[model samples]
Target: MTTEPREPRATDVLTGLLADLRAESAVLDDLVAGLAPEGWAADTPAAGWTIAHQIAHLAWTDDWAARSVRAPEAFTTETARSFGELLAAGLDPVDEGAARGAAEEPAALLARWRAGRDGLLTALAAAPGDARLPWFGPPMKAPSMATARLMETWAHGQDVADALGAVREPTARLRHIAHLGVRTAGFAFSLHGQPAPETPVRVELTSPDGELWTWGPADAADRVTGPALDFCLLVTQRRHPDELALTAAGATATAWLPIAQAFAGNPGKGRAAGA
Candidate 1:
């Protein structure tokens, strides 16, 4: 008997995303769990950032995300004042957050990170399905927020892996990141002071397991095609476009490859080719 798979409900989709979020976090935890105290100070690919900075940034961001879900008023008040002021003055709130978090002792930082991850999962699960959480960028629902978190986790984990000369096994979890990249085309363009095309670009990638993952119109003139890992790495600014095998078939797609950012916040300078 052939039974067709039912379309997933919104709740079910969000649940699956949350599960993947947990798995992504667990992978990073496993990567850093055995690090010595001094290992935390080792430099990662991100300039001036160390292994501890990577974990600290995750913990700090997770704490804020939980607050955004659980305490909207507080999130609003703080971001409007503290973060707004910093950004208005041309300072980076993200760098400030990372620096402050990185000052904590490694053991204490690790414990706080673990506790915050558990707390964030609980808060996200408890939030009403239609409720939008406040954030540095536009407000997002639990599912989108989970996807964003998963994207950051994997991107930063890449830095950590590079620093340690460890190779991470790509997983289906990257689908969330690729989806975010596709959805944020307009936002990415706007961040770079460029106009977003009215017509969306088609993205076709060969996934880690060799399945074709696609987004956008079937016959879009603008297209990005490549290995899914390369696309993910490009969108996250973890790898330079010149160092990757991704192909851009139109003007918009060609311009986009250089400035695509899956996560929100400031436009990244991105990586140098062969760096």
Candidate 2:
């Protein structure tokens, strides 16, 4: 009988992802810490979410994940798109309840948020090495789960920073972001109905630890290099790389800019670095 290919378990990758999540969360908090009340209501790059909404969303997701890990039975299978959805939507209903006059105070929200985050970490730490849990649209094992959380936090946090006109202190753990970017190279081409580029593109990202994480050919003329955070921001459509110090070479690398998509499902016509 045929069997599925085994997924890779690089503990290092998961460790890095966890670090990234924590770092980005700190950045988000710093951006909001001393903001005037008006700043909380400010419109962010996210279409309809305000700065406050973004923070609430992060808190909500961590709580959702915690609940799902603790008691997967509370969420009906019919209501969830995937196991991932159950966790992602975890504390959202509570937040929405508060938004709709449920009267949750800011202090209450903060306390709930910390509890949720801690719960998620606890669950992750205890999860089996090979456990394949449901998430958003597909089943991801532990490492990917960590990476996805980190990516979402960083991407969304970028919106908050942008809205506040503040700069985030990025970390090397952003290599996780850059890694996802390079891995999606083929997806980027296929999304636009174009054949995958024949030439291999090289990616080199400087991690927070001062180590370099690389993918593809080392000497390839077509290359993308920058601080990992900027690469992640560009590909995720959080910010334009042109606004940062990110560099790209070769026509193929440049052409793939508008089509990069790290997430699964339908392809997106995301804005290019210049667009």
Candidate 3:
């Protein structure tokens, strides 16, 4: 017998997303904690950024996100000040900020990160059910913001793992990242200066637990099917589409794979095939 699709409840989704966010943060914390002092200086896949830079960036972002949720006016004021300082120093805001963070002693950086993480989690948990928080791009509701945090933590954690020549076990939390990738397909296209196609595209992923997680209209003419891990890697620009086992049918779906991005920003130049 055919089973009906289970509709997601808002409360359940928010709870699950928050739990996954905490889990992701914990995993990253553990990874960094186990690293040797030299490991912090090791260069990661993102050219020029060391493991320390990755952790520092995460910390800085978490602190900003917490401020955004807890105090809008202060967030705006501090963001402008930070940006102005970066410009005055003749530094790229993101790169210079991360570098400055990385320059701190490892223990101090870790402590700052932990504090930021705690603050962000507390603020997110206390946000109103429908409250929206501003980000570098458009504003997002608490749930979406939390999911973004999870996705970034996972992606940056991959960089740290790779830098240390360590392998990470894939987890079910990847389902959220994959869902974000699919949900943002249109935004990805728009970021690349193309009008998003109107054609519906089905996404079918085999979860790490071997369960099927499907999104979009099942009968859609365009479709993407693959392992959820690979989908996450592609969306995060960690793996080239050519290096993955994903398949895309129809013009829009095919075009999307190379440019798929889960995070909000400029269209990233994805990794070269097998890089």
TM-score of each candidate structure, all chains considered together: 0.95, 0.73, 0.93
Please give me the total number of clashing residue pairs in predicted model 2.
6
User: By lDDT, who's the top model here?
Assistant: 1
lDDT of 3 at 87: 78
Off by over 4 Å in 2: 1-16, 34-36, 67-105, 189-199, 206-211, 219-221, 241-244, 250-252, 264-275
Off by over 4 Å in 3: 1-9, 84-90
Off by over 4 Å in 1: 1-5, 84-91
Candidate 1 contains a number of clashing pairs equal to: 0
lDDT tens digits, residue span 14-107, model 2: 6656666777666766677776666677887665567777777777667655555555555336235443564586754433632532133445
Q: Rate the local accuracy (lDDT) of all candidates.
A: 0.91, 0.67, 0.89
Clashes of each: 0, 6, 0
Give the worst 10-residue stretch by lDDT in candidate 3: 266-275
- Per-residue CA lDDT of model 3 for 109-199, tens digit only, reads 9999998988888888888778778788778898998999999999999998888878888999998899899889989999989998899
